[model samples]
Target: MIFAAILAGGVGNRMGEVDKPKQFLTLGDKPILIQTVEKFYLNSRIDEVIVLCHKYWLNHTKDLIEDYIPNAENIVVVEGGELRNDTIMNAVKYIEDNHELSEDDIIITHDSVRPFVTHRIIMENIEKTQEVGACDTVIPATDTIVVCHDGNIISDIPNRNYMYQGQTPQSFKILKLKECFNKLSDEDKRSLSDAAKIFVLNGEEVAIVKGEVFNIKITYPYDLKVANTIIDDAKLNISDAETGEYKVNLYDFGEE
Candidate 1:
C-alpha cells in the first residue's frame, strides 16, 4: 500500500502575528495545507493519505474536508504532536493500530507548507521506495554550502557536486522504518530531524530522487510572497492559453 502523511503541526512562529498557522494560510484559493494534500489526493499511485494537523486546528481541518476532500474515506485527520518526528510517529502508530502493513508497503511523509509538490515527485518516491527500503527527494545544490558553528566562522565547505538540498515525500517501507525507529537510542530520538535521517543514522542506505526547485517549504513571510507570485503567474499563464492571448506569428520570421 502507498500511503502519504502530511505534517501540518507547526505553530507558525516565524510568520509573526498571524491569526492562523502557516499551513492554513491561503496561497491561491485554497489553504496551503489543503494544496499539499490535494497533490497526494489526486495522485493515482497513492492509496491513502493521513494529515497530521495541529491539535487546535482539528475542527478547521474537518471543515476543509467538507469543501476539499469531501467523503474521502481513504483520507484521515489526526491531532499532531509538539515535535515534527512525534507527528510522524503518531501516524505510524495509527496505521499499526488500525491496519496491518507489510515491509513492502510504502509511507511517504511530506510537509504541509510545501504545497507545490508535483505528481512526478510523488510517483518517483513511490517507485524509488519500492526499489530501496527508503528514499528522499532532493535537488542538486546550486549554491555554495558552509558548515559553521555559533553563526560566526565557516568551519568547512563541502564539495557542491556531492551536496543536495533535501525536500519532502521522504518515503520508507513500513516495517523497515518501524524497525529503525525501534532501534533509536534516547539521544538519536531527541536529535533526529526527519525520516530520511532515521535511515542515515542507522547506517542504512537511502536512495535520492531529483526534486524541483519550486518545491520550497513556506517558513517565513518572504516565502509566502514568493508562493503567491508563483501561483499568480501560473494562473495568468493558464488564462492566456485559454483566451488565445498566447499566440505565435509566422509573419515575424518571413512574409508567409
Candidate 2:
C-alpha cells in the first residue's frame, strides 16, 4: 500500500499573504491544498493520504470535506510545525507513533500549494521509486541560468545543458525514507528544502523522473493568473472533446 504525505506546512512568506498561508488560499473556488490532496486520492495507486496542516487551520481544513475536496475516509489530518522540516518530521513521527508501516509501503511527499500535480505524475513517481530507492521529478531549465551575488556578477553564465528545475511529489520507499530520516543529524535539521537531499548528503544517489511543465507551484500573485489561464484552457479543451471525461493538457501553457 502507498501512503501520501501532502506537505501543507509552508507559510508562503514570499507571496506575503498576511491573512492565511498560501496552501489555504483560494484558487478560483477550492483551497490549493485540497486540490493537491484530490490529485493523490484520484490516483488508483494511492491507498491513503495524510495531510500535515497547521494547527490553527485544522477546523477550516475539516470543513472542506463537505464540499468534496478531500475524502475523509482515507484521509488522516495532523498538525504541522513551524519549519518545513519540522512539519515533515512531525508527520513522520505521527506515522511511527501510531502504526508500524512495512518496508514495501511507499510514502510520497508533496507540497500543498502545487495543486496542478497530475495522476500521471503521481503514478510515474511511484513506478520510478518502487523498484529503485527513490525518485525525484524535475523539468529541464528553459532559459540560460546563472548564479549572482549582491548586484555584482559573481558567476558567469551557466550551461543549461543538463540543468533542470526541481519540484515536489518526491517519492521514497517506506524503508529507505525511514532509514534516511532515522539517521538525520542536528545539521540536517537546519538544512531542509528537499527530502532526498538528506539521503544525497549522506552518500545515497537518487534517480530523476521527468515532470510535466504545467505542474507548477503557486507562489506569487502572477502565478495565479498563469494557473487561471491553464485551468481555463483545460476546461475548453475538455469541453471540445464531446466526451464526458475531462482531459487536461499537461504542460502546454507557459515556458518552464
Candidate 3:
C-alpha cells in the first residue's frame, strides 16, 4: 500500500502573528491543507492519506474534509506532536499499530502547506522508493550557497552545481524506515529535521527524484503571496471543457 502522511503540526511561528497554522490559511478557494490533500486524494496510485494536525485544529481539519473532499472517509485525521519529527513518528506508530505494512509498502511524507505538489511528483516518489529503500524530492539549487559560521561572515562558498534544495513527498519503504527509526536514540530523533535524514543517519542510501521549481513550501508570508499568484494564474487557464461541464450541471433538474 502507498500511504501519504501530511505533517500539519506546526504553529507557523515563522509566518508570524497568525491566528491559525499556515496549513489552514486559504489558497485559491480552498484551505491550503485541503488543496494539498486533494493532490493525494486525486492521485490514482495513492491508497490512503493520513493528516497529522495540531490538537487545537483537528476538529477544524475534520470540518474542512466534510466540506471539500467528497471521499472524506478515505482520509484519517489525528492529533499531531509538538515537533515536526514527532508528528511524523505519530503517523508511523499509527500505521504500525493498525495496519499490516509490508517491506514493499511505501509511505510518502509531505508538508501540508505545500499545496502545489503534482501527481507526477507523487508518482515519481513511489517509483524511486520502489527501486531503493527511500527517496527525497529535490530541485537543483540555482543560487550561490554561502556557508556562514557566524551572523556576519561567510566561512565557505559551496559550488551551486552540487547543491539541491529538498522538497517533500519524501518517500520510504515502510519496513525500511521503521527499522531506521528503531536504530535512533531519543536524542538523535529529536535532532532530525527531514524524513530522508533518517536513512542518512542509518548509513543508508536515499535516492533522489527530480522535483519542480513550483513545488515550493508555503512557510513565510512571501511564500503565501507567491502561492496566491500561482493560484490566480492557474485559475485563469481553467479549460473550456470544465466551464461547459459546470454549465451543463447548473441546468440539471432533480430526479422526477
Q: How many residue pairs clash in each candidate?
A: 0, 1, 0
Compare candidates 1 and 3 on TM-score and give the better one.
1
Candidate 1 Cα outliers beyond 4 Å, as residue runs: 243-256
Clashing pairs in 1: none
What tens-digit string does per-residue lDDT give for candidate 1 at 1-256? 8889999999899998999999999988889988889889888788889999888889898798768878888889998887888888888888888888877888899999998887778888988999988999999999999999879989999999999999998999988898898899989999987779888999998999888888899999999999988788777666675778755322111111
What overall lDDT goes with each candidate model? Answer: 0.86, 0.77, 0.85
Best by TM-score: 1
Worst 10 residues of 2 by lDDT: 247-256
Q: Whose lDDT is higher: candidate 1's or candidate 3's?
A: 1
Measured with C-alpha atoms, the lDDT of residue 89 in candidate 1 is: 86
Which should have the higher lDDT, number 2 or number 3? 3
Output the TM-score of candidate 2.
0.88
- Rank by TM-score (best first): 1, 3, 2
Ten contiguous residues with the weakest lDDT in model 3: 247-256
Off by over 4 Å in 2: 69-71, 149-151, 243-256
Give the Å error, residue 102, model 2: 1.7
